[model samples]
Target: MPFAGTSPHEDYTAAVERVAGQALGVLMDAGGAVVPAGFAVADLHAAQTRDPDADLPGLRVLGSDALAPHVLRGTPVPSDRAEAAARAFAVFPPDAVGASPDTAWIVTWRDWATARTLTRCGLALDVPAPGDGAQVADATSWQTWSVRMAQLSSLALPGLDGPIHAAAREGAEALSRGLVRSMLRRDYRTAARIARWIAWVAADGVAVPLDLAPLLRHVRVFGGGSTRTVLDTRIAQHVTGLEGS
Candidate 1:
């Protein structure tokens, strides 16, 4: 049903929101408090008024977007959260039928994130290794490829480094074009993801051709407050020395 490893649009959006909220807290990076994630399932379930003991269909589809923040933070991860993240993946593996590159990349990063989160705590999660041919759709047209890369912006974390990170660094020019094009087209979410990539690559000392200050300023001033978009921008802000230094 639903082509496997995917959820309905409304439920998926809610699931992303659920994790983005946790991601925001970690992104805030307050002066000194230890930002521990809550117990496995969050208040979203309570908000749903469902049977807490039963796994909700939507929640099962959360993937590793739910754990990327904790994985990237390099902080003490609550055991339950790691286990919860593992369970979500167990229910919806990355190599499901007909999964898009966007969904596939996020899950690839999730496998990496869940493993890292648990490993940091001296634990292990049985995550499947991402297939070798994952997310390499094509790159002949950088503009279109940028859109594909934008979906994997969750990979923009400082702690997460791999070929994808290197790709963002090497493809800075194309990413910039994608960023500018998205801005012109008023696709703020895409713009936000590209901005996160710019900031991430910039952190690696790659001279991002775009002036992030004004771009970030515009995103803040004009980008409508979608939780997911806000989370991306906030991570960009944190990485670029705009906030949470």
Candidate 2:
């Protein structure tokens, strides 16, 4: 009988394909003059199937070398490309975080994703609640704070009981600080992603201190047409409990 869930190879392949497709979509949406390097996908597949230990090399070749720098450096690629790169990094296994200094951003991105997933699934396992005494003094610390905000946002989603509302309320100040920092740096991609969580918090009847309305408005205005549509549709689907409502 077939395995009940995806095999390791299958998971790796799916991740590679998703990232590649998103990267390609970014290039297409931007009408970019330079084509993405083609070898990364093949290299990733080979590494995953032939050598488990080669995953880091494959991720570097594809994400670090090919996609990440362009996104981080704020190169001329479309905003969607940066968003896609960030999303791609979020999907990497936790072990991939320490593979290289160049890939360090993956740690924060993965934590943010985990926070959201955990909240969405309503599982608080090992999640740091408010007043965990976490501090944000450096990049690594800021990543941890991001995770905290993400968890707070998730906990604020409707239907959760207990002290989640109080926890989310306690986290609002920190989340506001993060939002302000992102806006000051003009890192709208980060700002927009964080804003989505804020929106979710408000939807759950918690009052967030920051005014994400204008920031989110700017994000929609600047985001490319197709990308914005896809994201808006997904958010709507999630909120309404309808597949394509």
Candidate 3:
């Protein structure tokens, strides 16, 4: 069945899972290099080239700026292009979120991933913290922040000390709470995504209340040639023998 029921929540969860699964396929095919074709780089380029104050409805100009860096990770791109993308990402105005909440959230979400990518490449970015003090007023917002936290924790970069670490732990708590809420609402697809993030965070050595160890093992066995493989490798590389209880 495409979805379990006719509920809107089920429909939404099914859509999100479809997108996530497609992304996984892209990641696997790219071997961790390049974003999926679904991101529409040409559209993003047009948006970025337009005037910031232009009256463009629903256009997320900073989308490519924030995402390109992560997409190019472990891939060969020219230094000038990489620098340009990073520069655009770095100078993204915080107030831009006021223009479009949805677009802004996406930009910020990818900004976090961009930071992780830069760090992985032995580079640094002066980007602002994502969702700092933001309230999770709904499931959508919670999922947005949860995915960002999952990306951040998965990096497990060395010398990552201080307030960022504290913030990650706090985000972990919020994600756990959100996970329970999603499950209670019978949003199993969302719950599964959250569970994957929980496993990712646990693999990164932060203590999460949920024990997805069995699930993780199952993924390792059957999640071959997919994003699950990527996550498993990351966990094995950086986790240092830590696993959820």
Candidate 4:
């Protein structure tokens, strides 16, 4: 049963949990790295939640930190995680609703796993756990989030509009990390591919429609940590066509 509470923070915590829980469910089905190996979608859904107890309504205050512990390892929820998470979400409630929250409730739940991570480590250390903040800019933990923001925005892709492009264009001038460099150059052929599925989903109207094998293959060729270079003119052309069409 959802926690019945009076405080806004409690309501928010319950809401975050519901959102993250749903997202995680979808992610589990999609077979993302977010979940532990061998854990099936049903298993995650059925898995009993542990730690952070969910007893304290104040946990909502920690915001992203509140949900970090449940999702990723090595991330501990700080005692102040609740306050930090709350503040983070308060900054952006729209995004606080996980990606496609209405349709991908399971994915949202999986994404909420970050709350566990935040609870374990505390908030001052990492501003936003993965997936907690929609845009990289919302991450107060790392200034480099701006770099990730750039990579997500630019690339001359069609239908992939918004601040991401602007961030990438601007970030290229000011932030020149190796990966950032490749992304700024539209050198996707060599850039590390983090969320090709998300990209595909974002670009295409269908859910997980693309055969991610090729993208993964290219990612392997690019190497996990290699600096990316996005010279996929074909993809660029497609994006251009999308924009023009």
For lDDT, the strongest prediction is: 1
Off by over 4 Å in 3: 1-26, 30-81, 87-92, 99-113, 119-164, 167-174, 184-197, 206-245
Sorted by TM-score (best first), the order is: 1, 3, 2, 4
> How much does candidate 4 score in TM-score?
0.25
Candidate 1 local lDDT, 171-203, one digit each (tens): 899999999999999898899988988988888
Which pairs, if any, clash in model 2? none
In model 2, which regions exceed 4 Å deviation?
Answer: 1-92, 99-167, 223-245
- The per-residue C-alpha lDDT of model 2 at residue 230 equals 27
Query: How does candidate 2 fare on TM-score?
Result: 0.38
lDDT of 4 by residue, 91-187 (tens): 5453454447332432232224333334344443323323333453444422355334433322223322334343443333233343344544545
lDDT of 4 at 223: 38
Candidate 3 lDDT by residue in tens digits, 1-245: 22234564443333333323323433344442332323322232233345332212111222222222234233443444345445544443545435366545545554555565555555576666666424323335655666544433423333333343455555677778766775566544344445545654565677787656554444344432233233333333223334422
TM-score-wise, the better of 1 and 4 is 1
- lDDT tens readout by residue for model 2, 1-245: 11238576655554444344343344334432222333233333343456443333223224322242232233454444334334444454445545464334334333443344333333332322323223322225544565444323323233333343444445555666776676677665455445545655565556668655565556555543223222322232233222122
* TM values, all candidates: 0.73, 0.38, 0.40, 0.25
Candidate 4 lowest-lDDT run of ten: 225-234
Q: How does residue 158 of candidate 3 score in lDDT?
A: 34
